[model samples]
Target: MRRRRAAGGSGAGRGLRRWAAAAALVALLAGCAPREGVEEIHYRLKWLYNVSTVGDLYALEKGHFARAGLRVNVKPGGPERDALKELELGHAQFGVASADQVLRAAAKGAPLVVLAQIFQVNPLQWIYRPDKSPFREPADLRGRTVGVTFGGNDETILRALLARHGIAESELRLFSVRYDYTPFYEGRVHFWPLYINAQAPIIGERLEKAGEPIAFLDPHRWGVRFVANSVITTREMLRQHPRTVSRFLAALLEAWREALDPANEEAAVQVLLAADRETPEAIVRRQLPVTRRLMVPEPPAAFGRIDEAAWRETEEILRLQGLIERPVDVRSLFAGNLP
Candidate 1:
């Protein structure tokens, strides 16, 4: 009986040791595995996929968000989609919006916060044949036919420009602009509003091919700094998921810096082409350098620096134009200390 008991005890002890070893091995494997708290976030863009969103698309394609343990769903915005509204309804955790949009929303009591200013210089500009327009000064705009999208930000900018230069609306013929560029092509309109990076390359290339010399009248050169697209989130999101916001921004801005780097031009172009198959590769190549110039014109200027002055100017423009009912303290809308 003692022998039998000893044998059973020894078998039981070996079985327990094996179980312990197996448990330890499982734990060891788990410890070495990738961390498991991956967050799923929805990010909405102000516009469709193009050179404008190259950095955004690059971040997703290159696994920047994945490396940061985030699963981001990047949704493109159009005329029907409003990023500010998406943020308000919890449809998106992060979104891109223009300064004017942000200000208008804040004026109407939206809890929005600006994460980063994407474009250091606004892309909206007037394209014209310098030979025909001879737009040497704002005064040159007087007695000329200019195209303006009546209710769009272009009108706001044009109004502000004329206001700044003391050029009244009656001084210039404000031609209503639409999707068709026939007026500009036929020289009926002296200056046409087109995004310098998006539409300029296509239109300018066509004009250049036709032996027409083109020049862009930059409002920034005349000191009309209406802020463009910017990364935005709700005040609640910033407060609740500060870490996630920081990580997302860090990943995004890192991707932007890399995407804008001339060294990575081919790779960035590939990314943009993959998302925007409609745009010809040649045009994207042309568009990218212009985008890089607008976003990071000076090498020393930070890519996502929030231009407070620009924001204030944007708000003041909105206020003076009666786009917003009252003043919105622009400073309250920015998350200046971004990671």
Candidate 2:
């Protein structure tokens, strides 16, 4: 599914043009608007319907937002509307975005707090031509055309990989190849950043079935670290509606758990197909396993728990990449704060 750009969040790290095609606002069908007697909450999406970007659907599907007494309106984000501004102006009661985006929003005093780290791993796959050409390793990408979306996790990973190899941005022909799969397939560039939630595996599987194949070189496997996406909210919401936040998180975790189950998988795909109407069912289905992998259990934690060790590594990558000037104390962006 395509992520329709909402608000100002689709900045430097964004790749895809956020596109919401067929999904109607479900709340609208149920007569949900800012009604006089009914309580309402607006959710500003980081983008429309990317699989990893499904906090709204997940939360709502499991009754988390409804349990919080919020008649949630899922607003598709765009390049012009700022998610932070929407939250600030009370246009949105909550937002579904990344920990990096929350950090930027909080730095601007958006009153946001990260309630949970949804994806334990940032699924960035540094993709190269399957022909096994010059872009085989981190050091090999010095002057290649490397593409990643702005505001997405791939930015952090790309910068970190460059830094690890001691390569300057000046040394490479870096281009913003928004999150479309055509660039690599047509041989327009040598390498591009990918997420398992987005492009790499879906196309890989499709091509393999068609008697052609491509492969992904995971940057984390080469000493790069970044997590894909997470659940973030405002600080006041955390403090004032503490139980509400907790309930929402619990419900969202439940949805995440169900999304991982093999039996319940088809229903989850149905929700996705309905939302990102432009994307094919095959592509959306292909992205599910990688998305499920994000919900896998960590050693000292249960399923759907965020791993601190992974986040610390991500922070280091962001700092080295100059995305975060210096690492703010990491204590602020983890579990245990919702209520």
Candidate 3:
């Protein structure tokens, strides 16, 4: 009886050892699995994949977010897609939106927060033939036909520009502009509104190849500081996941700095090409430098640095234009004190 009991004990001990080893092996395999500690979040862009979103694409392609233990779903924005709405619907945690959009949403009681200002200078500018227009100042715009998308931000910006220069809308013809560049191409419109960083390269190349001298009329040069695209999130997201916000912004801004660096020009171009196959490589290359200049024109003006004065001007512009029903306190819109 004693021998039988000893054999049973040995078998039980072996069974216990085998069970422990199997559990340890399972734990080791789980540790090796991907996304164990990483948090996944969605980020919606203000526009489609283009030179404007180079840094965002670069961050994802270069593993910046992953290294920071974040799995980001970088989604594109377009005419049909509204990033702010996505945030409110809980479909996205972070998003990019123009200041006017933010102000309008805030006026409607959207609990949005601006995390960072992406473009130091607004990329929206008027492109024209320098030889034909000879625009030396805003006054030069008088007696000329200027193209503006009536219901779009360009019109608001154009009106603000005219107001700043004491030029009335009646002074120049406001040609209704659509996607077609026929009016501008045929010289029917003297100045056309297009994003300097995105559309300028393609259109400028076309004009230059045809021996036309081109120039850009910058609103920033004229002191119309209507703010542009910015990074945003909901107040609840900021409150609930402050650490994630910090990590995401840090990774994103760092990626922007690297993407805009002259040393990484080729890499940035490649990243843009990967995301935007429709844009030819040459045009993308051309677009990148302009984008860099718009986002970071010089030192002491850091990328993603919020210009509070610009925000105030943007809000005031929206209110005066009646785009928003009421004034949104621009100060309350920023999540500037994030840890």
Candidate 1 at 240: error in angstroms?
0.9
Q: lDDT by residue for model 2 over 1-339, one digit each (tens)? A: 122322444442231111111011222222343432125656677666668755457667657667656666767776666665565544554566656665544333334566666667667676665654455666777667777776556666677777778888788776677656677667677676766677676667766776754666677678765655566655545554555556656766776777677787788888777778887898888888877776576566765566666666766665555555334545565546433
lDDT of 3 by residue, 144-263 (tens): 999988788888899899999999879899899999998999999999999998899999999988999999999999989988899998766666567777889999999999999999
**Global lDDT of each model?**
0.84, 0.61, 0.83
In model 3, where is the ten-residue run with the lowest total lDDT? 1-10
TM-scores, one per candidate: 0.87, 0.75, 0.87
The best candidate by lDDT is 1
Candidate 1, run of 10 with poorest lDDT: 1-10
Better structure of 2 and 3 per lDDT: 3
The order of the candidates by TM-score, greatest first, is 1, 3, 2
- Model 2's alpha-carbon lDDT is 0.61
Between prediction 1 and prediction 2, the one with superior lDDT is 1
